[model samples]
Target chain A: MKARVTVSLKPGVLDPQGRAILHALEGLGFSGVTDVRVGKLIELELAEGTPLETVEEMGRRLLANTVIENFRVEPA
Target chain B: MKSGVVVFPGSNCDRDLMVALELVTGTRPVALWHAEAEVPAGLDLIALPGGFSHGDYLRSGAIAARAPVMRAVADHAGRGGLVLGICNGFQVLTEAGLLPGALMRNAGLDFICRDVALEVVTTDSAFTRGYRPGETITVPVAHHDGNFQADAETLDRLEQQGQVAFRYAGEVNGSARRIAGILNDRRNVLGLMPHPERCVEEAHGNLDGRRLFAGLVSVLA
Candidate 1:
């Protein structure tokens, strides 16, 4: 089984890297790019039949810092 | 005074902390490897030094926070033992849930390395007892992800409870409330982004950082 975790900074949390990317895009004459946010996508290989809850636990414990980031797990 | 310095594989400031502890406490600190499941008994202080632990992969200090030895460190902290995390150490503490808030990338998106002025926010904790309240001290801060952030309620509680130990005098990092150092609720654990160990001696061109270690030793000894 394959699992994917997408981690992103919480709303209202400042994402400096994302902001820098936005500025760079603007400098390159890209318009209508109103905002930017950076995030992480982590893919995991797990044993068959592994529960989604277990993968969520992994996200809670390590993949995402609940203080500043939120994570979504997609198991495939 | 007895002390131990936790040595994660990428921890570059372990020796610096050991030297500072030895100079201030008059005792060599034990180097506790991250793999060790337990800290030696009878240790008074455990210091976590700064570096890109685990190559800052995934996140800074994220991997090191789950090191086998952290369980023992938490137990020690639970017993009211003193724990000090500096810079990346601060990141580790937050990741370990020993402290509140998380350090994020600097708002400028640049690695800042310079001596910055900090105000002693509170002297109520064992870590900041040596400094006068509101005194401005100069300390070196070298980090990319030193900007601290938390929800408004947590920030308010930290202020109301006097858990805020130090704050930057000016805009140093885009830290919430300009926090430079903060103490845990029990006041035994402190996590700060500044490198006090780097400027504890006259040779370092600043003695302001010496008071933190000396004050801690005085209180514990």
Candidate 2:
């Protein structure tokens, strides 16, 4: 089984990289870009019987810093 | 006092921390690798030096925080051992849950590298004992992500407990409350974005940072 984690900065947290990307998009003449919040998508290859709780623990322990970021796990 | 400096793969300031420790304590600090599961016994302090650990992959200090050595550092702190984290080390300490708050990218989105004026906010902690409260000193801060942020409640508690050790005297980063350094709830651990080790000697242009290490000696003695 594969687990995919999408990590994003929490609401109200500043995203400097995302802002830079948004600016770059505007510079490229792209329109209708309201906002951009950068995030990371990490794909994990887990053992067949690995529980969701285990994966969530991984997210809490190392994958995402709960202080400023949030993460969700998706089955793939 | 016996001290140790945790060295991750990309850590560049381990030697500098070791030198600082040697100069202040008159003893060489052990260089513990990130792969190690335990710090050596009988350590008075554990210093996490600055660098782009794990090349800042995933996130700044994110990967290195999960390294084996950090587990030991956390345990050591739990046992009341003094832990001092600087620059990227501050990021790692926050990631490891040893300190409160997160270091976001600078509000200006620039990699700031220069001497920044900092005011001593709390002189009661072991880390800031040598400096008088409200005294301003210049220390070099070199980092892209040093803006500290925390929830309002935590910030209030930190202030009430006098855990805010140092604050930027002027606008340097977009840190909440202008916090440049902070002490943990237990007050034995300190995490700061500035490079005190770099400014320890007068020949290095200023010795303003020396009192921090000197204070540590007095506290731990």
Candidate 2: where is the Cα deviation over 4 Å?
Answer: A29-32
Residues A1-76, candidate 1: write the lDDT tens digits.
9999999999999999999999999999999998999999999999999999999999999999999999999975
Q: What TM-score fits each model?
A: 0.99, 0.94
Q: What is the interface RMSD of each candidate, in Å?
A: 0.5, 1.3
Question: Candidate 1 chain A — worst ten consecutive residues by lDDT sum?
Answer: A67-76
* Correct interface contacts retained, every candidate: 0.94, 0.71
**DockQ value for model 1:** 0.94
Question: What TM-score would chain B of candidate 2 score versus the native chain B?
Answer: 0.98
The window of 10 residues in a row where model 1 chain B has the poorest summed lDDT is B200-209
**Chain A TM-score per candidate?**
0.97, 0.95
Q: Against the true two-chain complex, what DockQ does each candidate achieve?
A: 0.94, 0.70
What would the per-residue lDDT of candidate 1 be over residues B17-70, giving only the tens digit for each residue?
999889888899999999999888999999999998999988999999999999
What TM-score would chain B of candidate 1 score versus the native chain B?
0.99
Whole-model lDDT for model 2 versus the true structure?
0.91
